[model samples]
Each structure stands twice: as structure tokens, then as C-alpha cells.
Target: MSDNKSNLTEYLTPLIPLAPVLSVKSLSFVTSKTKKQQSILGCSNKLQLTSGRAAIAIALEHAGIAKNDEVLVPAYHCESMISPVHWRNATPVFYKININTSINVDNIILNITPKTKAIIVTHYFGFLQELTSIRAVCNEHNIILIEDCAHAFFGSLNNQVVGSIGDYAIASSMKFFPCYDGGILASSTRPLGNVNLKKPTLIFQIKAFFNIIERAIYYKRFGIAGKGINALLKVKEWLWNNIKSVSGEHYTCNSPASSDGGYGLEEDWIHKSTSVASNLIIKQSNTKLIIEKRVENYQKIHEALSGLTTAHPLFTKIENGFVPLVFPLYVDAPEQSFDVLKKQGIPIWRFGEYLDKQITEAFCPNSTALSAHVFQFPCHQELTNQELNWMIITIKKTIK
Candidate 1:
């Protein structure tokens, strides 16, 4: 048994994740000589594509969604998330996000009409919940279920990962581990339909390449360039909104290439993963070890601030080793708390604005209340303990 175990360990060692693709430190270069080694070869029983968005679009298209089908979607998602269903000529039935947990789809199920064909579930901000009830409902109704694991990877309930439980699973690789752009669509019930992988046009490819380079440069010099770009974009937006007549060239400026920072048209699939993303994955380095550290810091902060302030951990108990995408703090007086925090240089946010509409009426009251009053603080992998301590001190000083 010992010899067999050793052999198994040796064989599986290379397959384990090495490191996070995006890091605060200079771990690898985009033009590194060893970058190309990470490209996947041949297809699997599952479909893997150049980008997560494209993968979801293709999966939905293959699922027989016609022009009149109604696809239920989480209202809290970005506009870009609904493109797949729209591309299939389907109507987007907006559903409310459960605020308290950011996991349940109570709002969506209640609003389901006869036209509803599928439900897209986002494991919001990495919080996993008991989905047995939701799955049971879908099974009973015969509605196709698609798990959107864009913010969640490897999260499980009752020994089943989110991706494995649904009729189909859509995962955005870039969101989790820093791959440039890629998605996985896997199905057990229905064989994924045959389809050709279309490469973005060459011009789009070249433009996207440059945009990636530009972003890298911007992020690397975030102290200056990041701020400058943000300020300039803000000013541009202000001008466009206030001076509509002068914005007559809006159509020209809003063309695809200009809007997307010169990315190529959406027809090519070069299948080239970014060097930065690949190197981060292959080196199996300790860059993401920072997330573990952040989790520890969050525990200390939560314990210290739990009763003194309204902020709380949404999960029953934050799962061990899971990185937090945001630390949500519910305040008694959101405006007051926000003002106090802002005066102290602590940036806080309320994120569920998209769920305030008609369809959102179906969302949980607890979620809605929390969403309206909660302020999210940065808990990204790179945050330092000292920074967290300072933030806590500032919050206490200002709130009281």
C-alpha cells in the first residue's frame, strides 16, 4: 500500500495547481520563453474554449434555446453576462439575488413563468449554499439548470462540487486563477452538441494582444498610470453625458475596436493562453498563499468588529482555505457609516443595485436589506494584516 501510494503521489503531483496567475509581485513575464508549455492539447469529454464567455454562449446555443425562450438570470450580474442568452435570441428574465447569502435563487424560482427554459446560478462572490432544495425544484419542474461558477471553483456541498451538480456547468478560468480568458462547459445528461471553434478575426486578436499589454503596464505602475487612466475615463464620461451634442461622433467612438481597447473582432480562437496566466499556473508557486494569509486576517478583524459594527460574514462559517472576493459589512446606518469610512480613507461599496427592479421583488427580504446597507471592503489576496488592522481602527474611530 505504501509503494502504491508513493507512485500515485508522484503521478499526481504535476497536476496540482502551482500558483495564482495574478499576483502583487513580479513572478513571471508575459514574454517568458517557457510560457507556451501550458497550452492544452486535444479535446476532452468536456468543452474548453479560449474565453469563458464564448464557452457559455456556445453551450447555451447548443441547448436548443430559440428566439422566444425565456432564460432566467441573476439581476446582480454585469451586462456582459447575459450576452450568451441574448445571442441565442432568448429573452432575459431578470431574477433577484439573495442578499444575505449571495447564493440562493429564491427570487428566480418564484418568478419562473412558463417561458422559462433554464436558470443561471452564480455562486455569488464565492459563497456556496445547500442547493439540494434548488436542485430538487429544477428536477421536479424539468427546467434545465446551468451552474455559473464564475466566482466559485472547487466549492462543494455534500461532497459534490457546484460544477458537477447541474445539467451543465460554466466556469470562468480567468476570474479564479488569472488565465487570460477561458471557460469550461461540461454536461452529464446531454452530450454537448458538435460545433466549430471560431477564432476571433486576426485584427481582433492583434488588438486584444495590445490591450492585454496595456493593462499589464497599467497594473504594474498602478500608483500613477492606474489613477491617471481612471481620472481620464471619468472625465470623458462626464463630458459625454453633459455635452451630448458634441458627442455626435459617439457612434464612431463606440465601435467595437475602440470600445474594447482595440481587440479583434469576435471570430477567432487562437487558443493561446496568456504567458502571465500560464506561468502563474505551472510554477505552482506560493503567490496565492497570500489568500490564506488574508483569510486569517479576516478572522481576526471579524472577531474584533463583529458586535461593534454591523459587518458580518455571509457564510455560516467562512470555509477554511477559501479566498474572499469581498468582505461584506452591514451597517446600522449605511450612509453614516459610509461617510465615516470614506473620511478615514477606507473605501466601502454597496453592490446589489441591479436587484432593485420588478423581477427583483422575488429576492429574499434579508438579502435585499443586507444588499442595501452592506458595505464591502477589499479582502483581495494581497491585503496586508497591518492594512486590515488600520482599517479596523479607522472604522471604529469613525463609526463610534
Candidate 2:
């Protein structure tokens, strides 16, 4: 192993001795006031499952968006977000991103026609977008505002949650929370009232159950799993391609998000605060130790890379609660840096690399720039100090 890898292994190996092994019994929790309190705070009554598209579907319906309506979306989002607009028979008007990597839409709004009904603003990478300005513009035009809180679960801007600012907000519980799957569509100003859920297909429920089992097994064997999932996904893709039609619409804030209760839950597709996820959310919510460690590691990595010519942090540190998803480094030449890091056995990712570059030409200049320039290092809760140091050293050595 390289010195950095060896150092990381040695550092983590000792922690394994001190750490308690995960047991099925320990995973179980006793009923308590704290647990009950968590359920109340976490939108326990409001969350539901869609085939993973509940958020957008709810937003589209609440906004009264109709066929051929246009909804503006950030050019820098996952392709899944656009599926709702297409499913609704509406068009997506792409908007550019600013240098700060926040949504920029001055040009997009100028081009907005009578068909434009709403805009979906994403708080990318947990950084709260400048929604105050966007809300102001939307109000003037009598356009609805939808906040994509998929990446901003606990994130807030100026003491207001991202989901609270807009006319409607949607979030996926699986992204930030420890839950396997679920999404929430919430409103503050308007009443969502009660939504009736359609029964999910039996095949989807079976597949979701097996997929969870497979993911658990892979995690146990490989430390960080999902390789088996990719193989399974390929087979699924092939089958889907041969098939002519699939029941139910794709999940989105604009459409009624579809749900097949994930894995075990068949009766309800929405996330009911399970004893398992409730505890995990509580544990992670007040994660002072994890957050501090990550912040420290981020500082070290930033300090070390600040001197490098091609590597630099993406945002200012002074922003309110600007916790990083990972320590991001923007390289002038990404493919070269990626190869150099890979050769050294460091795992890295070109975050959101799958975004449609061609469609981006409509708006999103900064999103396009970031797509080619930035790479993420793993800074999830499991990271250790040794791993952080090794990562810093690896970056210092790899970057010219």
C-alpha cells in the first residue's frame, strides 16, 4: 500500500477495536418521550413515498401547473428532476448558475412567456441558494416557487428552512437521513390537506425489498457497497428497454409521486417514522462530533491545498452553516488530476457528472464550468482523522 493508504488503514484499524460492532439487538430501540418527540418534529404525519418522485409531483399539483406549462429549473440538477416536467407534458426552461455556483436566472426570466407557471429552485450541495431574490421575482410575475430540498434537509437560510420559503417544498428522506427511501411534500402558506395514495404494484415492492437486502449484504462485505447494485440495475435497464409501457407516472413535485412501499412496508409507501430511522435521525441530527471532525479535516485539506496552483475550495467559509457534503477541490485540469489521484489509490468523484451538458447550453454557465472542474473527497460521517490527513497528503503530492 502507498504511505497514505497505509496511514489511513493504521489509523482506522485501531478505531475498530474501540468501536462496538453493529448488532440487530442494539439496532432496536425502546419507546420513549425522546423518540416520540423526534417523530413529531420530523414531519412524521406528512411524509410519503413515490417511486422516488413524490416531491416534484406534489409541487406541480399544488401550483396548479397544467399541460404545456413551463417550469424553470436550474441547469445544474439531476436528470430525474426534469422527468416530472416532461411527464406533466410541460416544458422545462433552463436557467444558468452564477459564479458562486448559485442559481442565476435574470436572462431566463426575461425570456419567460405566458406559459411559465413556476420555478424549481434547488439548494445545491446543501448551500442555501439566494431564494429571497428568486422569490421576489417570482412574486412580481405571479409565478409559483418550488424549493427542491432534496439536498437541504436540515439546511436553513436566514432562520427559514428552504422548504418553508417557497409556495411548496419537497425532500427525499434517504439522501440526508439514514432511511432507505421516502419523500416529503410540505407547504407553509397553502394547505396540502390530505392526499390519497394509490396502491403500489406488487413487482415494485418485491424488487425494493430484495434491493435493500442486496445493499446491506454488499455494505457488510465491501465496507462501502453498491457494485452489485450497478449489475442489477443493468439487467433492470435491459428489461425496461424491451418493455413497451410501465404503469404509473414518474415521480416529481409536479406529478402525484408514485410509491411502492420500500422493502418491508407494503401497506403505505410513505415513510412512517420507523423505530429504526427515528433513532438514526436523532443520532445524526445532533452530531457534534462528526460535524466537528469533518470541519477540522476540511480546514486541514483547505490549508494544504491553498498553496497548490490548481486546487482550491469552492465557497467562502463565512456563509451561515456552510457545512460541506465533501471537501471539494476545483482543479484547472480535472481529468489529469482524477487520473493522478486514482493512481495513488485515492477514491474521488466528479459530482453530478451525469447532468445533460447539451441541454445546459440553454442556461447554466457556472454549472457547466463546475461539471468539468470540481471533484469530491469522501467526508461522510464514517471518515477518520487519519483518512483526512492521508487525503490532504495525497492531494498535496498529486496536484502540481
Query: Highest TM-score: which candidate?
Result: 2
Give the per-residue lDDT digits (tens) of candidate 1, residues 140-203.
Answer: 7778787776555434556555576677776654444434445566665667656655544454
- Clashing residue pair totals per candidate (backbone < 3 A): 15, 17
Q: Superpose all Cα atoms of candidate 1 onto the true structure and report the RMSD in Å to 1 decimal.
A: 12.9
Against the correct fold, how does model 1 do in TM-score?
0.63
Worst 10 residues of 2 by lDDT: 14-23
- CA deviation > 4 Å runs, candidate 2: 1-45, 50-52, 198-297, 339-347, 357-364
- Candidate 1 Cα misplacement greater than 4 A, ranges: 1-21, 24-55, 75-78, 81-83, 94-99, 102-113, 178-195, 199-294, 320-323, 337-350, 359-364, 390-400
Error of 2 at 293 (Å): 5.1
Alpha-carbon RMSD of each model: 12.9, 10.1
Compute the lDDT of residue 117 as modeled in candidate 2: 95
After aligning candidate 2 to the native by TM-score, how far in Å is the CA of 73 from where it should be? 0.9
Candidates' C-alpha lDDT = 0.53, 0.56
lDDT of 2: 0.56
Compared with the true structure, what per-residue lDDT tens digits does model 2 show for residues 207-317?
A: 444444454443342344446655676787677655634544453221122221111112243423222332344343433433444456556676777777777777646
